[model samples]
Target: MADFSSEIRQGIQHISESVFMRLCEKVGTSQRVAMRRETVDIKEMVEQQLAPNDGTIQMLSGSDREGFRLKGSDVDHMYWPNDHRVIMDMSQSEYYNMANTTLILSDSSESPPGFTLLQLLTPTTDIDVLLTCFRINDRVFISSSIFRQLTYLASLPNSDIHGPCVSGDVAGLEYDDTLCFVCDYWPPSASSWIDRCQSWPDPEVVDDIVRNGCHFVAVGHPLGPHANEEWRLSFSQAEYKCVYAMNHSQFLTYGLLKLFLKEVINHNLGKNNTLLCSYHIKTIVLWTIQQNTLPHWCPQNILVGFWVCFKLLLKWVREGICPNFFIPQNNLFLTKVNGSAQNRLFLQLHELYKKGLACLLQSSSVRSYIIDVLCSPRLYICTDESIIKCEVDSDVELFSEILQNDKTLAQVFYSCMKYLYKVQQLIGSHLTQNQVVMLQRLTASILKNSSFILHNMYTYTGVNKQMYIADKISCHMLKSAAKFGCVSDMFYIAMYYYRTLRYREALSVIEMSKVKLAQPYLMYREHVDRDRYTEAVGGQSWSTKMRKAVVLDIILDNAICYINELIPEQQAALHNKQHMLVIPVFLMFHFLEFLCYRHIDTTLSQAALDELQVLVHYDQGLFVRDIFRDISWEILGICQQITGNLQAALYSYQQSLEQYPLNLIQTATHTRIQDVVSYSQNSN
Candidate 1:
């Protein structure tokens, strides 16, 4: 009977290992996780560099920063003025230049374990901060409620306040922006946590966490006496670093726990009614790792790690005490998880624990993996080579998404040449290998757009030495951009050549671009022939193929990349603050080829014109994203009008007006239609 029990346990372990292997493929492998971290870091670095130098720091937090692309997850942004500093005592204020800083002292004596009252030590000249302060007991203290209200006022229209965050929808995704104050010193409340972290995180990580200190968010404890005046201590930066330090298996396990909470627990107990959240799950994982509860956190032992976290959560629920990871004395669940709610939650967790591995079946995200593992005990679903291939595929998808969402043109226009110089400085700074490659890609984009702006500026100037110098500089910048940019970036050189009336040189560049675009590994937008991509670039590292693999769009900035021929179309896109005239690579390629060939060979020009017509008519979202469809049709109309097909050009303009008005070129299309109609009437 004992032997039989041991065999059963061994079988369960084997099944768990297999399920975890499948999870690794689904979630991400170690290499993929590392790559994602590097990508996020690089993006944050770029954002910081581009942000206005107005003594404010902006940081991305929450799951997005943690490298999880979970559906419905909100993008969290934390921004704080650097001049407003919070200190534990007045002595800490000596470190700052008082003339330029607003110092606030943290008073946690009467507050909750993780909360504090911010007393203004010096009068702030800033009206926004001054309005949030009031005199109490001969000391001016910043009112949390007033601070929150002031922050909310600056939020997006139709946004609502959620605790310290102002929440709203941005580009169809939910965003939470929090206004916080930075503290240069580590909170004494979390001193025990630093001492407790003797292992798992290593000493250097702990030191880095402490050196970065914490933040004071404008949110008071619900049960504290100073509810309206208290500010909660936030370890967001420290928490992000901790999550970054997690091993891939551990990270995947954390992701699984979150999935379970969302799909199973919350699904059973209504999302709005549940007290358990991703934060609670994160805390459980942190404690489990720090306490060395699990012997190993590898792919094979992922299930065991998850089970340990689950039992710890159950214990917390039963005891009605969910301690904060940074300050164990602070109970995270004190306000919500108690009394009947606590009892009910405990019973539900207990019932799920009794169901054992079968409880995972309730999670739709991982249910199929669990079922597969159970159904095929002998099959090996994961191997090292397969996992590496999966990582590469994930890298391709991530890189493509980043390119598709590129905003380099607008950023460059906003910052002008200052942004370019900052990027150069970033490249020269100490950076990881992956960071350098990512920054190089960004630099290429900035250079390409800046050159276009420079050339456009020259078009408005007289023929002189300055014009000649600007022309040479713009040409050289384009050459440098093509050297560091992706396959599609070569088209910029062709466009420049054509713009200067060098038809033969433009044709030569266009021919080279066509050959590069034909490469199997070249990813265009979200489209990639995966099998061919793998076959061609499978052996290369992600950094090696990152630049050469993707096709970036050509965005014409109305305020910068001004072209006299496209002024009518560019005028339509000027409705927004950042007037973007986005054109797909394929559309621009064919249009430029036709334009250049019109000067060289009419036959080839006709062929290029025919191809453009076909693409504009039959493109089933293969060449253009839906948002750019109107522009595509409008481009087609322009070409048709040039070809003297007045009736066809009028029809194309009508079709352009019929699509979604996102391209914002309906006014331009109407003008073109009227021009075509009047020309036809005069001809008849």
Candidate 2:
């Protein structure tokens, strides 16, 4: 699809300065924005925003000028210089492609192939989805306990819980419920950019918005827009209660909150969200996600680490790193080293190498992408470093004498990495492991360490590695192969590609591994996971083999539990069109063909799996993992004793855990392993 990042960055900076400033200049002079952001107005964009539009939606509308306000809106205004072509291209890509090719409008023709792969994998993909999870308070408690409370999600053996029952209507209607979040519609004229920002028609649009989540401009003087508690309280409150810190009521703003939410979900897809923020504010210490751990360690979004990385990179360069630096179109130039600067960069890269790629990517998804993207071979890096002992040792190194050792350098490096990661994830990241390896190799070779990798990517993998390597190589070769080194290397490799903003490359590297990374997609697991997967399949593969492999494995391996979730219509649909429906389930069943019917097929607690089994015929091929079949059956024999029946509660649990790869559960699975060991655990 279209590169949403550039538009987002452009939009963000535009909102901050050009949009906010001019509006404020006009409105600050008059206390209002001239138009509503909700409407499509051609005149407003051309004349006011000073931006062009593709033939489609003419102008951005705004009516609720006072309801919302932009604070520090001019902070990053430089990124949004008055560029008409940029704006025009954004409108074109969004209106023509992104808008038209959405899930709701899917059809044989109008339906893009991207959504298909994602469609078939829903039940399994959704197994890990957190219904209404969020980090409350600074400590970042997880909501799996809440998920544990839900009989339905809990019904799926491997699924984890989110928060207490936070239904959309009643999600925040609890005793602790703070301000009620609202996005009520505004009249067209009272519409302003803020209104448009608050309302998105499509989930994809919303996702895009979330990723490029708007940064709040705290309105009140010192603290900003977040200062207005009056605007946040519930309308029915009698005597005002300062329930929580930041007045939960007035707790808005503070730099792209939606982006932060996406990050939280990315890191904790099916795993517990224990790292939720603490409810009380004063004790709210800054919770920084471990450079590697992310939402798991702190599922809540912690932008500090990312900020450090970005700031450090900026500091090192003493200027802005052009977005083009990471995604240059010319291939030959990709590897061309520019003399001293190149050498200097190479030397600095050694430290990164020593720290290891895993260490680099451990934090969140965005960091992984950042490291991978910037790691490209052609980057102009600084080579050697001299102390300038007497302040005259070298030209660029001349200033090096004033500072001290590598610790300061290390700190700066750390900051750059963190910032690069957090910033990119906010909008989107596009790096991968193979690219990271390529970058590592490129960096090592430049530093006279090129031979570190077992093979040259361009030669072994191919030219234009981004397009050359398929998802297969990324997993079967790069991730699983011993040569690329440990997961850390792969992770950093992913981060390197991501920073260069090569989202596809970044995603490949992270997704290659069996386990989830703490990156943004993982942090905001449900949304990014679904959105990206859907986007990749282009709408046609959702209900097919292309669905995420892990999800498919879970479904087929435990066909019964999945069937249990379906209603009669679904059953009739599957039965009525066995010719058609069988294909998708068949694909999942076949993928885990290594695990047999005698095991998974007969093992389900729900009658659904059994019903599905009778509807289709199996190929004559031998089952792959026959050993797992007996092993799983043996475990079922024990559970049978506790539940007192062959097809009781134990059977469902057994069926849920049956078949498929063991590793998927190794991470997200939460269980009470047991109180004591028993010798009778062996017999089937």
Candidate 3:
């Protein structure tokens, strides 16, 4: 690419790294260490009483256990009673009798967020037993032991020293808000109800994560009058694994996302509002990493990734649906924030996008760490995905056998194609890994062979003109491929329409592709032969579904809108075959469209200039003797000036003078850069 002016380079780096540094400060290492120590102590204390017999009733959770907590974050401990059968077999009274006989029962009427804890005073530390029972298996035979255990604990047994051995509550557990711990029991069956997550994640990663001992947590219903009995399986362990696997840049990106949600988005919406949480932000980051390639996540491109994730969050917020990462059925935002509040959060994020990072600039110790490197061009290059390109060329038979045996191959094929389509530009192609290239070739081969087969069938059947193949076969081969879940074909077919200038037809195909995208997730229940596919339908988590939706939306909003939003006259101009179009003119049109559609103009202008610079570098033929070159240069300077990069603006103006055609050069214009810089300095 074209060299960015020093000032613009410095500005981008300062803002990006400043935001990143602030996030590190917010989730400082010292705090993480303290939280870890406290969590270990709590786990040890809870285990001392509960773990000795069965080694079951013990496991601390929350950010402390997950390894991504901010300072002073609440550490959650789950006292998993391992006597699954005994806990479920006994009656409420009998269960109470058993628990009371084993440990000293406390009548401390304090109940924490989810459970009823039995307070215990030890020699060194005071701990509470969360009288919760859970299961590791999903079989219905596996009982809801935790619920029964809690029910037994909640029984009333009056005493002299403790005021009352048990409270008046039917289930010994009482919700007193003052209790340091409460047992939130998820029955074993309920706790392990859902474990079909094998369909969504990469097979390699899934194996690694499973090996790390990720089990479902028993989470109760969000909208329960008494959610004690109704437990939902949780993927918190899996989620923790996903986060912990991230490289340094990925971790930083995730931290930044959480900070944006808290310090910026949540800050804008009042504290009382149930704004987006760090969990939701973390979920978004996990999905982002899974969907994109390794090259796409290079350290230098962390800011781009952060921006992409923020946009995804905005889309979810605007839709008023933040689904639980592992379960699509559970909408995290259902009771969290209403439409008005969601709208406010959306607007706040939109403001950040428009105003650029300058809106979040702060004078703090965090910002000081990166001050020297803030101006380094290495971290602040124009790293947008718009400039990447993906291409495929392969024989039709290459992946035929794989597609036949591996149902998930089709889905992967579709994802690869969609990824390629989004990143491809006329210049500055993105680097693709071997895996992506292989998938692309395999998908292309399948599509080519299918089309060839269909053509041959038509030729043979149409010749007789009676009982034709189209009717008899209905293209059984393609239908079978579709049944096997070949989503990539739809994308390829859509591109054909898009390229032929059939805008409306292209839009319809694009819409259909989205339906096909969700087909596996939605119609999964109906597919009896689930084993045929490495990934079963309906197995996608909430984050997976949202990620797919966001991908489609980006394609539609950016690529499709380029066609749909064109005015009649502009549309007509595009159809002219004889006339040549300059690359800058076409790109500038898109930049203007983005400016018109968005709430802010500065970022759009910067992105547009970045694209133009890239184009000039890779495809100089497009700008040689072209009038748009001068326009691009002058506009770059103006955009830099608007964004408060005076030195960059001066450099851009100087470049503009150099690029001007012979007839356009003038002495008055030559001095413009110096004069503008002098004026800006005096004003400052």
Query: What ranges in model 2 sit over 4 Å off?
Result: 1-154, 158-160, 164-193, 196-684
Per-residue alpha-carbon lDDT of candidate 1 for residues 197-308, written as tens digits (9 for 90 to 100): 8886878899999998999999999999989989999999899899988887788889889888888888866546888988899999999998999867876666677788
Q: Rank the candidates by TM-score, best first.
A: 1, 3, 2
Answer with 2 or 3, whichever has the higher lDDT: 3
Most lDDT-accurate candidate: 1
Please list the residue runs of candidate 3 whose C-alpha ends up more than 4 Å from where it truly belongs after superposition: 1-50, 54-56, 85-205, 208-228, 268-272, 362-684
lDDT at residue 469 of model 1 (Cα atoms)? 93
Each model's TM-score, in the order given?
A: 0.81, 0.19, 0.36
In angstroms, the error of model 1 at 13 is 2.3
By lDDT rank, best first, the candidates go: 1, 3, 2
Q: What value does the lDDT take at residue 588 in candidate 1?
A: 88
- Model 2: per-residue lDDT, tens digit, 366-412? 34333533454233322112211211111112111111010100012
TM-score of 2: 0.19
Could you tell me the TM-score of candidate 3?
0.36
Q: Note the Cα lDDT for every prediction shown.
A: 0.79, 0.24, 0.41
